[model samples]
Target: MSLIHALVAQGSTIMAEHQAGKRDFSQATQTILSKIPPNNSKLTYVWEQYLFHYISEGGFTYLVMADDSAGRRMPFTFLGELQRKFIASPTASSSTTSLAPHALQSTFGPVISQLMYTYNTSPPTDDLARAQSELAQVKDIMVQNVEQILSRGERIELLVDKTDTMASQATAFRRGARTVRRQMWWKNKRVLALGIIVALVIVWIIMAQFCGAALRCGSN
Candidate 1:
C-alpha cells in the first residue's frame, strides 16, 4: 500500500489517527511529531524506504507515512485532502487551548480511516484522483532527510534548493516518456490526416480526367 498510516495532532498530542497495516508506527510517529515546529510548514522527512509527509498549520499537524515509491506528490496530496476535511469538520472549531489528546478519535477517527483506505487503494494516476489544484504547489514544498530534523545544530528550515536526486531523476524520466508518447501520437495523427487528404485529391484528379471538371459526360 502507498499510504501506511496517518494522524492529526495538536503539538505532540495526537487527536486522531489511522494505521493501514500490521506494523506499529506509534513510537516513530510520536517522535517525529514532537520535532515538528508549531508553525505553518510543509515538509517530507525521508527515513529508510519510507517518507513521512506533514503539514503544520494553526497549531495542528496533519501527517501521513508512505512508501518512498509513492513519491512526494501522492502523500502530500493526501495530506491536502486531510487538511481540507479537518478544516470543514466541527473539530476545527474546538478550542486548541482546552483540547485533550485523541479527543477527536471517537468522532473523526473513522474519517481518517476512510480517507486512508481511499488514497491507499486508489493511486492518483489522473487529474480526477488528485486532491485539488493545490497539488500543483507540491513541487515547491521542501524535502529533507530525516537526519536533518534529528540533528541538533542543523537547520530545519532549509530552502527547497535541492530535491532527492533519485526522485528527481525518476520524475524527469517519466516526463520524458510522456513527451515522447505525446509526440508520437500527434505524429501518427498528422500522417493519417495527410494520407486521407492525399487520397481524396487523387480520387478528385481521376474523376476530373475521366468526366471533365466542368464538362458533364455520360458513360459511353
Candidate 2:
C-alpha cells in the first residue's frame, strides 16, 4: 500500500498530516482539497499518479493520497476507519474539536498504522469481497441489537410502572398500620377507665350496707 499522504482537516484547515515529510504532505493535501468539492462521494480523480479520496464528517474532512495502483475503495475504507478513530478519541469530544497535527498523531498514530498495515500492506487480492463480507456481518449484528433494544424497551417501561405502584402501595400500608395502632391504643384506654369506675361503685355499695347494719344494731 503506497499511501503517500493522509491528513485530518477542520474545514479547509489542515490540522494534521502523515507522510515522509509532514509539511509537504499537508501542502499536497490542501492542494488536492482545493480542487475538489465537499462530500463528492460519487466522484474520484487521479492527480500526479496518486489517487485521492475524501470523506467529510461534520466540520472535519478526512483525506488520503494513495498510489494509482491502490484501488479507489481502500482510501474510503481507510477514511472511515480513521474518522471513527478520530471521533472516538478522548481528546475529541466532537467533530468541531480540531486536533493539532502532533495531538492527532499522538492520539491516533498507532491506530492509523495498524489500519494501513492491515488494509494496505499486501492486502488480499479481493479486498472488496472481504469488505463486503465484513459489512454484511456488521449490518446483521446492528439489526439484531436494535431489535433487542426495542423489545427490551417495553419491558423496561413495564418494570418502571410496577416499581412506582409498589412504592405507592407500601406508603399506603404504612399509613393504615399507624391508624390501626392508634385506634387499638385508644380502645384499651377506654376499657381500663370503665373497669376502674365499676370497682369504685361496688366499694360505695359495700360501705352503705355496713352503715345500715350498724344503725340497726344501735336502735336495738
Candidate 3:
C-alpha cells in the first residue's frame, strides 16, 4: 500500500477524495483534513506506519496517505501532479466557498484514484515525476510532529508579539534621533546668530571711538 489514499478539499470540507488498498483510512483521513492549516503550506505527518503529506494553497489542500517506505519525494511529486490536474478540471471552476462535502466526488474522484495507482505502480524516474520531485525539494516541506503542530498557533502568536515590539522600539529610536538632530540644528543656529550680533556691536563701538560719534576724526 505505497499510495493508499488521496484527498482534495477546501479547508475541512471534502470536495473530491479517493482511497485504495484494503485498509480503511477514513478516520485518519478525517483527522488530518480537519487539522490542516488553511494558509499556504506543505507538511508531512507521521502516524503509525504510514505518512500523510499535504500541500495547502489557494484555500485548497491536496493530501496523500502512503506507506512509510514511500519516502517524501514521491508522495509530494504525486501531490504536485494532482494539483495540476485538479486545476485543469472543470470542477475547479466552482467557487470554493460554496462547495459542500463530497461535492466533486462524481466529477473528480476517479482522477485521484487513477493518479494514486500510477504513482504506486511506476518508478519516480520519469521526467515529469523527476521535475515534480525537484519542485517539492525546493519547497523544503516541513516534517511536523503531532505535538508541534498542535502548539504552532501559540508559537506564531508569540513571534508576532515580539515582532511588533521590535518594530515599535525601532520607530521610537528614529523619532529620538530626529528630535536630537533638530535640537542640535537650532542650538548651532542660535550660537551663530549671537556671534554675529556680538561682532556687529564691537565694530560699532570701534567706529564711534575712532570717528568721534558726532564728527569724523579726519575732519577734526
Q: Candidate 1: minimum summed lDDT over ten consecutive residues — where?
A: 152-161
The order by descending lDDT is 1, 3, 2
lDDT of 2 by residue, 13-123 (tens): 666556632324444456545544454332344544556667665667777777778766566667767788788886457445554545556655666666666666665
Model 2 segments beyond 4 Å from truth? 20-23, 35-43, 94-103, 122-127, 130-220
List, residue by residue over 27-79, the lDDT tens digit for candidate 3: 66677777776689888987656788999999899999888898887888889
Per-residue lDDT for 140-190 in model 1, tens only? 467767644334432333323343667899899999999999999999999
Query: For candidate 1, what is the TM-score?
Result: 0.61
TM-score of each: 0.61, 0.48, 0.62
- Any residue pairs clashing in model 1, and if so which? none
Reference-based lDDT, residue 98, model 1: 52
TM-score of predicted model 3? Answer: 0.62
Winner on TM-score between 1 and 3 is 3
Report per-prediction Cα RMSD to one decimal: 16.6, 18.7, 7.3
